[model samples]
Structure formats: C-alpha cells, structure tokens
Target: MKKSPLYLSILSVFLIAAPFILTARYTQHVLIVVLLYVALGSAWNILGGFAGQLSLGHAAFFGIGAYTAAIIASKTAFSPWWALIAGPAAVLPVALLVGWICFRLRGPYFTLATIAVGEVVRLIALNWTTLTGGAVGVVIRPSLLSGTSKLPYYYVVLVIAVVTVTLCHLMSRRKLGYYLMAIREDEETAESIGIDTTSYKLRALALSAALTAMAGAFYANYFLFVDTTTVLPLALSVEIVLIAIIGGLGTVAGPVLGAVLLKLSSEIFRNEFAQANLLIYGALLVLVILFMPDGLMGGFRRLFGVGARKSQRVSA
Candidate 1:
C-alpha cells in the first residue's frame, strides 16, 4: 500500500517544529537561506530539469521580481501581499519574449542565450539609477508586525518555499510535465509523438520564470533591500542551477535536497572559516558533479532501489 498522508503530515510537523525547538538564531538564519535557494532551485528545475532547457539567465526573472516589488512598495501604499504578484507579473512578458527567441535554439546555444539575457537585465538594473537606485539599491521599510525580526522573515520564506515546492510537484505530475519530459528526452521524438514541443517549452519557461520571480519578491522583502548584484548577479543564477544539479535533476525532491545541502554547507563554511570557503565550496561541487552527475538524490535512489522497487510494486 502507498504510504499514508498521516505519516507525511507527521513528518512535516516534526520538520516545522525542529528549528524552533533548536532555538539557535544562526541555525534559523541558515535554514531561511536554505529555504530561499530551495524555492529558486525548484523553480529553475521546471525548465532545466523538466523541459531540459538550461537557462542560465534565471536571475533575470529574479531581479525583475525584486525590482517590481521594491518599486511598488517604495512608490505607493500597496500592501506587501500585492508586491508578490507585481514581481512575477512584471517578468512574465520578458520571459515569454525570451522563450520565443531562445526556445528555438537547442543545447548550449540556448544556455548561452540565457546568460546574455541575464547580463542585459543586470546591466539595466545597474544603470537605471533613477528607478533602481543604481548599484546602491533601494531599502524597504520594515513591515508592520515584528519589524526586523528574523522569525517573521523566516516564516515568510518558508511559506514561499513550501508553495514553490508544491507547485513543482504538481507540475511534474501533470500533462504539461509529461510533455516537457518528452521534449527533454528527445525533441524530435516528442514532435513525432504529436507533442507541440515548442509551445510546451514556452509554457515551461513561463511557469519557471513566474515561480522564480516569486522567490525574488520574498528575498527583497526579507533582506529589505534590492540591488543589481544581489538580485540579478550571474553567480546567483549559477547557484540556483548548482543546487538543482547537486540535488538531482528531474526529480521532485532533488532541488530541495540540493538547496539544503549546498546552502547549509556554504553558510557553515563561511561562518566557521570565512577564508578559502569559496574554494572549498567549488571543490565540493566539482567532486559531486564528477562522481554523480545525476545528483545526490539520484544516487540515493539508485543505491537503495527506491524508485525501481516502488515502480515494480505498483506494477505488481
């Protein structure tokens, strides 16, 4: 029999309470950053993992979202809730346009195109001093309740993290998910099987962009500031991809695992030994990629035969 939802609920309860129970502010902050990357990694997987579209420019959507939310909150008296929608809303058209152009290309070309797009967005954010406050960035006023409290920010990011992961799970099981997977495996074969590969890729890109934008919104609010480097940096995009890759691409839990492991390790390294942390981080990533290209989750599943056994049991 399939595992009961009750078991899953209990697990979730334990996870939610564990951090508070530990009562370590530093640990909580690390967890918050993990949640942020988890959302971003999952969102990136919608295209990179599902559709096999390697978009290195995902930070563009992220930056757009951050800027949109910042602008709305700064200029008007709009509620922070609305800022969430505003960020994703602003990036939709750009995503669609980029999808139209780059989706036509395959493999490395598409990846390069995405990198260029991210750079363009970053440049715009840097130069648009009047609007984006230039490189200095815009500071956000604290929210009404628990101003500057880490707990409130932590919960907000956690909610967005949960929502993002949930959405990715649903998408992976839906028709669109199948279509994207088909294209990922073989575009020509998918087309031969009567799938509209182009349209499906575009759809995946749109969804990925929107979801990533939402993460950006939360990041801006949580940090209470927005800058070109922080929001649209190439390193940020790479970090998201690295998390998904290290976790396990094309699996629901891969990005989550990857994000948590990578972010936690990085944080610990930075805190414990600020010097040579990046070198250590880079070395670890290289090792993971070299030994297990399919990622940590994939290796675990293979080693334990979890996926194979489950499928076999289902078939039986």
Candidate 2:
C-alpha cells in the first residue's frame, strides 16, 4: 500500500535531470517555484493537515527565516550558505512562542491567532527600517550561486523539497503521526485517551516551522534579496494552504502534485489569458473545491477504488 519509495525515487531522478533536459531558463524557473512550494506546502501539512491546526499565517515563520539569512549575510562576512542552519535556528524559538500562546485556543480562534501573529511580524519588518531595511529590503551582498542559469537554485530547492517530503513520509509512519492524526480526528477523545494534544501540536508546529524556514532561507539565497512584501505576505500563506488542500491534505505527494498543477497552470494562464488570468485561476480553484472537496488525490482514490484499504487502516 505504501508506494512512496518507488514514487519518490522516480521523482528524484526526474528532478535531478530536469535542468539538463529542459534547458530553458523559464522552464527551470517554474520547476524551482514548484519545488519551493512543495517544501512550503508539505511543511504546512504537518501542522494544518496532520495536526488539524489550520494556520493562515505561516508566512510569519517564512519571513523570519528569510530575514535571518538576509540579515546575517548583510552584517557578517560568513557565506550565505550558513543561513540553511541559522534561519531555522532563529525561527524555532519564535515558532515555539507563537505556538505556546496560540495553542491555548482551539479551532477558529487558534487560526485567528496565527493570522494576527503573522501580520504583527510583517508590520514589525515593514516599520523597522533599521534592521530589515524597511521597504527597500535587504540584499544579499554575496549570492550563493552567481549567474542567470538558475540551475544551481533548482538543485538547492530540490534538495529542500526532497528532505521535507521524506521527513513527512517518515513521520506519518511513526507514533507522532498517529498522535497528530488522533488529535485531528477528535481532540476530546484524544485527550480522554491520555494524549497530550497541546504537546503534540507544539511539536508538529515546531517541525513545520523549521522546514518552512528552510524554504524561506532558500528563497532569500536564490533571489539574493529579502523583504516583507516578498516573504511575509498573507497571500503566500494562503497559496501554501491551497497547494496542500488542492493536491490532497494529510498526504506526502499532495503538495508536490498541487504545486506542479497550480504553478504550471498559472504560468499557462498568464501566457494565454494575459489580463484575465487571475480571474480564471480563482474560478478554477473554486471549481476544484466544489467538485472535489477532498482534493485530487481523494478524487483519484474514489474513482479508481484504489488505496481504500490503506485509507481505512489509517483512519481507524
């Protein structure tokens, strides 16, 4: 039933050979964006899908990671590569603090708290001209991969995507994944059964935060720039959630598939529709939600009658 290993192995080969095969800068750029979203969406799934804590403000942690890398690069002589570690290190405490405060509330209240926290952080970055450079943003003095090829950036994000998804797959088969799923299904019953819902939720958030920050760090490095508008936008968070949901929530492959479909389609729409792309994109997403409420993966399963036993096993 668990065929992720074969799928991931094939995916890895395709990703590794993508730049060489595509050759076009634009195509490679799109691939990079897809991989980046794969990382972001998958990270969010840990908290939102697995733990059933929908956070609309994940951009907060993402921005923090971007800033961490940008700030360090601006101030110190250290290579920008250091941010892969520093970004997550900086984000961990802030993520824990936010979780500690917000996890006290449940359902929509918790969701609202996350949104507020994300906005507050964005405001801080916007107003604090001294550290974050205000609207001008911080530019990485020395970019990790110099040149316009985009191939290097592709591999960097691909690595992040692979690591994040692999971790998610592993976690889903472990005790933590079961606990988080239990919490998602029924918090009261989970608590009654002696599961520390808050603790597990916090752990999920922490893991999500770290992985999200890693993607943020990659974003900053690849772009050689960092700004609140670019990294801390509510729209970015919404896109992340949509990626997971449209692909299939609580599944490792969902985000990757969602990212591919969404990004490629958006690119096509932009090229073809030009002025009406956004409207069309919005309409399409609405249609997908209405017709396939459980997402593409769920639809596939229902249509083919595949993975039914696995689904029942996991649910039970």
Candidate 3:
C-alpha cells in the first residue's frame, strides 16, 4: 500500500512550519543539516541505490564542485549563485570521465575502483596548492550567510532539497530510470535486451555528480570555506552511501527518512557528548544494519505494509 496522501500532506505541512516554530539558530541549524543530508543521500541513491553502482568516489564530484565555486569566488567577481550552476557543469565532464574509466568493472571491483579514484582525487587536491589552495583551503571573500539569519539559508537548501526529490520522482517514472533498474537487477540481461548499460550508467553518474555538486556548492558557500580533507574525504563519500543504506536503497523516500533519523540523531548526540558521537554513530549503524539490513524505510514498510515501495514496480 502506498503512503496515504493525507499523511504525506501532514508531513509536508509540518516540515514547512518547522523553521518558523523553531527560532533558535542551533535548532534551525540542525534542521538545515537534516535537509542537507536529505539532498546528499538522495543524490547518492540515484547511482548507488537505483543503478546499483556503489560509488565510494562521490566526494570527488563534491570536492570538484566546492573547489570550483571556491576558486571562482576567491579569484573573480562572480556571485556565489553562479557557483550553483558552475559547480555541476564543472563536475559533469569529470564524472563522465570517471564513469568511463570505472564502469568497466563489476561488483566489488567497481566499489574498490571508486574508493581508489576518490583517494586519488583527494590527494591531488591536497597537493594542488595553486588551484585548490592545498591543505590551507579556499575561503570565500564575502559570506553568503553574511548578516543574515540562518532562516534564509535554510529556505535555500529546502528549495534545493525539494528540487532534488521532485527530479527523482519524475525520473523514476521515466525510461532512464527503468533502464537503470534493469541494469541494476541484472547487467547481462539488461545488455541482452539492447540496453546500453555503459551509457546508461554513465548518464546516471553524470546526473548524480551534478546533484552532488549542487549540494557541495551550497555547503561550501554556507561554510565559507573548502578544503581537500573536508570536501573530498573518504568519510564523506561513505556517509553518502550509508545514509542511503540506512534508509532504503532503491526507494525514493528512503534517503529522506534515513537522513532525518540518522542526521538528527547524530546532531543530538554530538551536542550532548561530542567525543562519543562517532562511537554512538558506529554502534547505531551496526545495530541497524544487523537488525534492519534493508534500512529504516524497508523495515518500516515491511512491518506496516502501507507505504510506497519500489518493489511494487512503482516510483523509486
């Protein structure tokens, strides 16, 4: 059974009112984080979940986007808003190149290739001082959030999050998404059916890179800085995949659900006990993976049997 339209409506209404209700900067910041992860997780879901291309190199795209914007902002007079578009544009070719190189392998090889590529990119960014500022990082001259409450930035991210979800929803109903699913389910079979698996996977990677770049642009502008370690870290890439896994792979609402629950919990734990956040996160992840391997959404739907499921041959 699909989620009730009324339930979804209520949830949307609540989310819309949350920023207004919670006036504190920190609380609002946490909410913003939830939205941020919602986008990040969803973006990763496109390639990793829907297409079954477990990329551990997404941070490469993310770092490219952030560095693109940061470099532009530091060297020129372009607005940060331009970074939104430029970020994705810059990463698209890079993503296509990476896909061309990495799509040759299958299964664990692909995953390992992604990890290696991500490390290579990070190392390059760390050493490329003239362009990326090396370990020193690039700082924006004027902050996007300067003289503004977190509210404006909150809405900006919310709009982007909405766009990301809407695009996923639309894509799920279309031919490209179906091709991706076919490839995911069985690549050889998909190839036998005349689907160009390599091309489709490349397309998915390109789109995923674009979306990730958008998020990276926002993150860099919001934070007013970008560094190789911070933007291109292996942990960030792993976090993207984990968020999707924790929710529900191949399900549209899975990433959102995972991001909300996981990011919120982490933030709360960090606030309460900063030093133990990783320990808590690791323990929670292990418990969840052990008990609910299908992720929070899959577990919930399995129990309740009343939500939109990707297995029903429906939207992602």
lDDT (Cα atoms) of all candidates against the true structure: 0.85, 0.88, 0.87
TM-score of each: 0.93, 0.95, 0.94
Ranking by TM-score: 2, 3, 1
Could you tell me the lDDT of residue 248 within candidate 3?
Answer: 89
Per-residue lDDT of 92-156 in model 1, one digit per residue for the tens? Answer: 99999999889878999999999999999999889988888998899987775436447777777
Candidate 3 residue lDDT tens string, 103-197: 99999999999999999989999998998899999988766566568887888889878888777776776888888888999999999999999
Candidate 3: stretches off by over 4 Å: 1-4, 143-145, 307-312
Give the poorly placed runs of model 2, Cα more than 4 Å off.
1-6, 309-316
**Where does candidate 1 clash, by residue pair?**
none
Clash number for every model? Answer: 0, 0, 1
User: 1-316 in candidate 2: lDDT tens per residue?
Assistant: 3455586688678879989999998888888988899999999999998899999989998998899888888888887777889989998999999999999999999999999999999999999999999999998875648676788889889989989998887788788888999999999999999999989999999999999999998888888889989999999999999999998888777787888889889999999999999998999899888887888777778888887525324432
Better of 2 and 3 by lDDT: 2
Clashes of 2: 0
